[model samples]
Target: MQTRNGDLSQQNGAESNSSSNHWQSQIAAVTRKLGSLPVQELKLRLPDWRNSLSTSENRLCDLLLAIQCSNSAADIHPKLTQARQEYEKFKFLCQTAQRVLTQNLTHYDLVSIAKISTTVSQPNTHDSAAGRSPALPVALRDRGSFDHFMQMWCIMTKHNVENMPKMGYKLLDLFQLYIQVEELGGLEKVDTEGLWHLVASKMGHVPNSQDATPISHIVKILSGAFVSVLAPFEEFYKERMRRTAAHWNICGPNVTPGTGIVPTEVHCNIANFGVVFGEVNIGLNDWMPEWSPYAKILRLTGMDLDQMQQQGWTDDLIRLITKFKPTIDAWREVLIKFLLEIWQHSQSMTGQHSLQHPCRPTIQFPTSQVPCEVASTIKGAFSIDEMQRAKLVVERLTQDILQTRQYQTCEVPEVQRLQMNYAVVDAHSLAIQFERIASLDYIVFDDQERTKTHLDQIALLKEQHQILQSGQQYYIMSLEEVVTAQQNFRTALGGIKNACVQKVKERQQQVTINFPQPDEFLIRSLLIKKS
Candidate 1:
């Protein structure tokens, strides 16, 4: 019984050794197969076989090298083919990690490496050997231990991709990579042509090529893989852009160019927005009426006066007279008629004949001397107070008449006849002067006070005449002296009339009359007082 028990123990020990030998033979065969592939072929196939039993072409290559340099499989504890494959996969991951570090890397590249490493390192039931230990050779096992080191390498190389030139790589290469990854059922699926079209659209390039298979075709083929490879980089760039945009306070909804149409997202935050400015109307046919006789007269007079003044008439007084000649002529006729009518009325009040004794003879006294007793008795028939009152009435009446003529009605034939008969051909000659005065809103009245004082002096002379006549002192003055004084008075009156007309013309020339004002009444009052 003791002999049989020993035999059984020996038989079991032989079986255990045979099982280990079988594993050793399998491991040796795989190591030989791995070693047979050239380094160039390994490098070329690394990316393709990354998820295979070899982990990647680089890991397989590294494993083959490691196995070739190590002691024989029989001397060391041998592992199963499955164990060898896992070992190869682990070694491939290590080599891939090293390669990844050697090249320029990015955060996305590191992430991919991490994922691939995790997948390779995870143990599977399919990887268990039937007769041998599941653990690999010590040299091969060292590859798995290098995982932490690979991760650190990835971290160190993460910033390298940033150093790449923007246009160094062809845009089409990225497109093809994207398509391949999509076909492999990677993270994302993208339509290659559609993506190209989208990019082309953004760039405003029309996809109207004549070639059946253009460069755009290759771009389409690679689009999916391109997107996959670039997605992380794109995300990284997008994150950077987002941060930059935030820094610039540029967070806002998309807006259409040229239309000023705000998106709903931004519209809600707008407090007050408006576009009140507009182009001014500059259309044809905005000119003043063509048939306006007053406008025509104003144009003619203005042109003529400007021409006259341009002919070296620098004296303000002369320029003033020339500028207002037409208006002064009109006012002179009106004043003469008005004064004649007043004298006729006064003569009738005194029971005197205007044709025989004529009211003109009453005012024919020297401006500087007293009137004789005969003319004084004639003036006494109307008291000095009554004469002054008459003059005031004449002034007010003339003002009303001038204003009524100017604003109440358009130029009719009868009105023109009345104006022409009064000796003025045009009323608009005064428009320029009146316009200049009115524009000031009377603010510059002080500048014109000297002219007003001159007018007051004329008024005082007329008053003195009436006072002398009422005191019966007109006989002391000779007929020749009286005629001379009367002529001087008429010339002074013409000057005053010319001055007023020139002022009106100047005002009209400088300002544009769009609306009426109280100055119109003042102008008419002055006209009436002159008359």
Candidate 2:
């Protein structure tokens, strides 16, 4: 009976295998009959099909569960089995097609991420040298193969979390390669055409039908507002130059070549800057990445953005892109550190060890700037009542900023001496760090009275910062003066000590001279008296 059972099981397995093969062959035949689809069309069509398939799959799953729970369903079991087999084969084909389409879509959106080999171009021609640059990576050279990527980067929006980490590493790798190449004395560039050939080849092979975004179109639109703010036009508000002026700060006070640029030197519609650049207050719990200034250009890409968010693809790609930003930041950090290291190296060569250089980032972090601004305005308070109110506000703001980071130093009322922290090596030192002290919150009422009150508070806050800053400078100056005075005193004391020692030696010699034999003479006189 056991051997019979085994034979029966083997026969059933063979039948199931044959059924699966028949289903696949029918699906292949249907796919060949339908032919291929364009990418844009596929992008639009696939999501609908997927949603329908999901609904069907869920219903089929429920039916299968019911079938498993039923003992009296043997008569209809063969029909149910055939339907399940067909559905499985169809689902497989759909998934495989979607995967291929996604790959094709990814190929179209290749950002220019490559190895960075720096070429120094100083103002002097003699110093400028375009050395051999490092070769671009496979991801850049053969962009079709993004599977083997070092980093994936994205501008952080809610949609792109999936791809962000990979994107970040890609950019980091690119930057790392740049530093490595620069360090290795690679200055000359690789052939531009050859690098792009990989992209062209990918595009040619893909069925997207010139679906990749053209370089010329992007360049033209983005650069549409390129104009010198100095060249004033009558219809400046309507002109694209307005955007340029607002962005570049071309006409501003203290930026005068011939004469100082007036506030109205160049006119622009402030609205052109967009909501991304505008400041917005958020509740402590809210996350609003789309409003960041860093996402301004991306937001400006206009109508195409709406379509991109239609499916999960946007989220996936965006995540990929956003992930690259940190690595880009890491790249920026590398550049900054390299520049600062150059400054440090020069300082070392010039024998300025006492003037210490920053090792870790000296750039302010986990610090509040709003408080500092409030503190500054309080320094300009004109009235006594206003000044008092400002001080109270400043004191509160001081507490707010202080609470941001863990510090051993207790918050003090009086201004504390801010340290020259660049000279210090220990990260955990409790010495007074250069910190933003305080800033007043925005006025609740728009009246001059309220504005004046806020400004006065900031002015009072500013006074404390001023005191702290001035005190630090004065302490340094006083320390130098005290050191110089002590050095002078020590030199004079040393000379006086040498003279006193010489005088003591000479006086002792004089006092002891030729008196050794007097005792012997007295001894002789005593002997004569005795005889």
Candidate 3:
């Protein structure tokens, strides 16, 4: 009798050991995802094989290295393959988790919602080994763990959506990982996790069934939860964005003179948030299962459609700001992004003679650039604000030249060689001048429709541009002809020598042309005084 009892105890011990190992193996198999577990909850999951140092390896890698190295198609393919292999392992883990969860739920076809509400608590000894598959993070497999993740996600979306910049590089990193995941999974698969992430915590609203619940009924419950969870964000965005639109000039005014006209903190935040929102939408679109049970209905239902749509700049930001309604697309930081690109282009153009690619501030640029003290990503050596300022200058300069048709005058060599170097048409000499002027912080016409005396100086630049264009045309037409004209004029001596001097001086100011005062270089404030 004592020997029989010993044998039974050993059998039970062996069974428990097998169960734990099975759970671990299943967890190791799930595919990797971009969603980062909150740092606090990092240790809250089931024991993982990875060390603490290795857990955040995906986000902590040098973004610059990954991006610059991936620039070449040859390099990208292999790295992507390796990343996918890693992702496959994660996917396996995910499947294993789902299986365990499904089994755990099977008991309630034997589930416990109250316990699910608790966080990071482990399942009972028997429950942990519900499946032969690998184990999962406690949050994914255990009912209580689900609530923690759900709550964390809600808190993040709530706060971060309000302050988009706060979402920071995480959004960018998430998007990059999402793209890689999408490439592997394709757009056809349903993001079951996403659906659960959005709604599972609120399943309390759905009446529980002691008998087996249909997947459709469960889905409806989750769907209702999704609607409830999303309500506050949508409403908050609408109200907050409305104010933003009305006070755009107030929110995004230029700083005083001598300080560069880079974007303000406000503008940077809006722009950063816009980019984050876009990635969120892209991820959602890619992850939503096309073959979902309601896929056929979705085609006509107008729900779960792609959320991203970007509009370029309107002629007037202030004007449009006043007219903004509460649609999601209306909050796009079009001006800021445009300015960022234009500024980066200008900076590259000014810095280098040529380019391997367009001058652009990539999200994948160095991470060390943003320090802890600044409490800002834009406070870095190069920032979105600086790009915005660059765009302003580039646009103003480009517009002035185009409006005055200064580049056209460069075609007439005889008309311009004596003066107006700023207008050289054959090269980017004109662009260079534009950059220089923009740097000077000269206020032209402001948002209030007020024009400045910079007009006279612009006219001078225009004439210069035309003269350079003409000089180039003449150079191409024949340098010899110009030489002959000069030789004939010097020898002929009387017919038009004085006229030539007068013609050169025609656009030149009669008196010492008073230049724009240093103070005039300050950008005009766009604030409309509330009457």
Best of the candidates, TM-score? 2
Sort by lDDT, top down from the best: 1, 2, 3
lDDT assessment of candidate 1: 0.35
How do the residues 1-531 of candidate 2 rate in per-residue lDDT, one tens digit apiece?
A: 999999999999999999999987977776543336677676676667676677667767766877889886785577577667666755765655554453343333211111111011111111114432222222233423321221111110111223222221231122333233222332222122222222223223223447754644422321221111101111221132223233233233332222222224222112112221221111100233333322222222331434435523346454543443333333333334333433442222211222222222222222222223223323222234654674566566555544552322223222331222221111111111112211212111224443333333333333333333222222222223223333332333233334333433555544322211322322332223211
Give the per-residue lDDT digits (tens) of candidate 1, residues 1-531. 999999999999999999999988975675555445555564556555555544444454555565777776553333334456676666654444323322222223323322222222222112222322222112113434333222222222222233322222433323333223333332232242244544434333334567434546544444543444355543433343344333223233343321212355432111111110000001101223332222222233345655645645346634554544544344234334434444443333221232222111221222222223223333333335744654454455435444543212223243233222111101111211222222121222333343333333333334333323232211222333334444443343334334434444565655332222333322343333111
- CA deviation > 4 Å runs, candidate 3: 32-531
Q: Which stretches of candidate 1 lie over 4 Å from their true place?
A: 1-221, 248-531
- Count of backbone collisions within predicted model 3: 39
TM-score of candidate 3 versus the correct structure, residues matched by position: 0.19
Question: Higher-TM-score candidate among 2 and 3?
Answer: 2
Give the distance in Å from residue 249's predicted Cα in candidate 1 to where it truly belongs.
4.3
Q: Each prediction's TM-score against the native?
A: 0.14, 0.22, 0.19
By summed lDDT, which 10 consecutive residues of candidate 1 come out lowest?
A: 275-284
Error of 2 at 80 (Å): 1.4
When summed lDDT is taken over every stretch of 10 residues in candidate 2, the lowest stretch is 114-123
